[model samples]
Target chain A: MSDKRGSRAADRTEAIMRTALELGEEIGYAKLSIEAVATRAGVGKHTVYRRWSSKGALFLDSLLSLNEAHLDYPDTGDVIADLRQQIHAAINLLDRAPVGPLYRALIGEALLNPQVAAALNDHFITPQAEKTVARLKAARDQGQLSPDFDLDLAMGILSGPLYFQALIIQKPLTHEYVDRVIDALFTGMGPRP
Target chain B: MSDKRGSRAADRTEAIMRTALELGEEIGYAKLSIEAVATRAGVGKHTVYRRWSSKGALFLDSLLSLNEAHLDYPDTGDVIADLRQQIHAAINLLDRAPVGPLYRALIGEALLNPQVAAALNDHFITPQAEKTVARLKAARDQGQLSPDFDLDLAMGILSGPLYFQALIIQKPLTHEYVDRVIDALFTGMGPRP
Candidate 1:
C-alpha cells in the first residue's frame, strides 16, 4: 500500500513540474505563478506550495527537470575532450526552441527579482558551476592542465564563449564554433615551453 | 542665431540624459519611464518624445552616453596591447555599480523585449563588435596575427570571458583576470612554431 501511494505521489509531482515548464515557456517567468501551475496540473494550490516555497522554487525545479539530463560532467581522462563534451551538451540543451526562450526568461527574471536570482543560483547555477570547477581541478591534479591554471578563470575561458555566442551576440551555437573555441583555449593552456 | 539654438538644444538633451541615468539607477530600468525622465529633467514630455521614439531608445542613449567615451577601438599597431586596452576599458566601464546594474537590466529587458534588444544591438553591440572585428582584421592584414586566426572566433575568445565574468558568474572584474584572459588568448593566436 505504501509503495503504491509513493508511486502515485511521484507521478503527481512529475505532472506538476511538466505543467510548470509548459506554462513558463508559454507565458514567461515574470508572469508564471504557483496558482496557474497548480491549476494547469489539475492540483490544488496547497499541493504546489507543499512542494515548493515560491514560484521561483517551482521555476527552478522546472528548469532542472528539462536540463538535468544534459548536464553530465564527463571525466574521460582527457580534459579537453571532457570539457568540450560538457559545454557542447550545454549548448545543445540551450539551443532547443523552448529551452532557449525558457533560459532567457529565467535569466531576465533573475536580473530583476532577487528571490528568483538566489533560487536560480542556489539550485541551478552553483551546482553546474561547481561541477565544472571540480572537473577542472581534477584535470589540474592529473597534470593534464598547467599547474598555474586558475580554475575559475579557466572555467570562464572554456564556457564564456558559448554563453557570449548564445546570449549576448544572439548567434547560432554551432558545433564548428564550439570546436574552434575549445581548440583556441586548449592550445593556449597546453604545456608552456 | 541657428548655432546658438543648436547648442541650447544639445544642452537640454544632455540634461535629459543625465536625469534619465540618475532615475534609472535609483528606481531600476523596468520602472524607468519617459514621463519620469521628463519630470526629473524639468522638461516637457513632448520634448523627450521629440528626441527618442521609445523608452528603449532613451535607455540605449543613456547607456551610450556613459559608454561612448570608452568605446574607442585602440589601434596602437600592437594587436595584443590594443585588444587588452580595449577589453580593460570595457571592464572598467561595466564594473561601475550603476553601470553594471544598468547593463543587467538592459540585457534582461532585451531578452523579453525585441525592440530593446534591437536598440541595444544597433547602438551598442554591433558597433563595438564591428570595431573589434575590424581591428583584428587589420592586425591579420598587418601580419601580426596568425593567418589561421578566425576573426569571428577570435572575437568570441577575446570578449567571451568578460561577459561571462560579469553577467553569469557575477564575479569581480579584476585587472588581473583581464590580463590573464588577454594573455591566454594572445598566446593561442600567436604565429605557429
Candidate 2:
C-alpha cells in the first residue's frame, strides 16, 4: 500500500475504535455491537470484521488505547504511600463513567469467552500486575516490605479488595478505603502489639 | 390445598432446582436457558418461571440450597484459624466442578444484569460476608483481633485476593494459598519488627 493508503487505514481504524468505546460507554457491553459501532462510524460492518475479529477484541483495543496512563504506579521513596496514591487514582478512574462500566463489561465478557480472557490477561491484567510487582520488589529490596511474603500474592492482596468492591459489589470506591487497605497491609490485622 | 397436591408441588420445585444446577454445571450459565432447564426438568417453561423469575434467580436458589452449609464459618475460638479453615472449605467448593463453574456463570450474569446482581448480593454474597464478619466480631470481643480495623473491610481483604485469583486469573485455589493469605492477614506484610 502507498503512504497515503496506510495513513488512511490507520485513521479509519482509530475512528472505529473510538466509536466502539463511545457505544460501549453509552449502551454498555451487553448491548454494544460491532454493527452499531460500524454504523455510528459511517463504515461498513465488513470494515470492522476485516480489522478486529470480535466485539471483545475491539473493546479491548479501545480501552487500552485511552486509559493506560492513569494507572501508572509512582515511586517516591515510600512504598505504602505510593500504593495509596496509585490505588486512589485507579479507584477514581474505575469508579467513574466510561472506564468503570467499560471495564465491568470487559470482565463480564472475559468470564464467558476464553479468547477475551486470554487477551485481557495478556494485554491488560498481566502488565498492570507486573508493574505493581516491580514496585513491591523495589520496596522489598529497600526493606520496606518483608522478603518473606510472596510478591505476586502481595500484588493480589493489595488489589483484590478494590476489584471486589468496585466490580463484584458495584460499590463506589473511596480514598479512605484505599488508605484502609494500605494500612491493613502495612500494620497487619493481627492483635495489637 | 390438599396434602397430596402440596407434596407434589414441593417435589416439582425440587426437581426443577436440581435440573437447573445440573444443567448449569453441564453447559454453564451463558448457554443454559430457562427453556432448556424446563425441558430437562420435565416441566413447562412457565412452570420454571412461576417459581423463579429469571435464570439468575433460579441459579442463586439452586446454589444456595446445596452449598450454604459448606461455607458456614466455624467458631473454634481462634479467629485466624477459623477463617483459614472456612476459606479452605469455600475454595474447595468454588474450585471444583458443579459449584465452581455454576457460580462463575452466576457472577457473569450478575455483571450484565442489575436484577441478578441485586439478587446475588441479597442471597449469596452478603450472607457469606456476614457469616465471616460474625466470626471476626467474636474474635474482636475475645481480643484475638485488634478492634481498630473495619470488619467489613477485613472481610473483603480476606476474600478478595482469593476471588481475584480464582475468578479473574482463572487459577487453581490451593490450601497453601489460603494459608499464605491468612498468614498475611495475621502476621502483616510490613517490614519485619
Over the stretch B1-193, how does candidate 2's per-residue lDDT look in tens digits?
A: 6999999999999888899888877777778899999998899999988888888988888877776697998888988788888988888777787787778878887887998998888887898888988888888899988778678687679888987888788788899988888888777788768
Chain B TM-scores, listed for every candidate in order, come to 0.90, 0.89
lDDT of 2 by residue, A10-79 (tens): 9999999999988887877889899999999999999999977888888888887776686888999899
| Model 1 alpha-carbon miss at residue A16, Å | 1.6
Which lDDT tens digits does candidate 1 get at residues B29-144? 88999999999899999999998977888987887787687778778998778777887788778777888888888888887888777787788777887898898788878877
lDDT, model 2, position B171: 82
Alpha-carbon TM-score of each model against the true structure: 0.87, 0.89
Compute the lDDT of residue B25 as modeled in candidate 2: 71
CA lDDT, candidate 1, residue A21: 86
| Clashing residue pairs found in predicted model 1 | none
Candidate 2 deviant stretches above 4 angstroms = A1-13, A31-53, B1-10, B42-51
Tell me the native contact fraction for each prediction.
0.41, 0.74
Interface RMSD of 2: 1.3
On DockQ, the candidate that comes out on top is 2
RMSD of candidate 1 to the truth, in angstroms, is 3.3
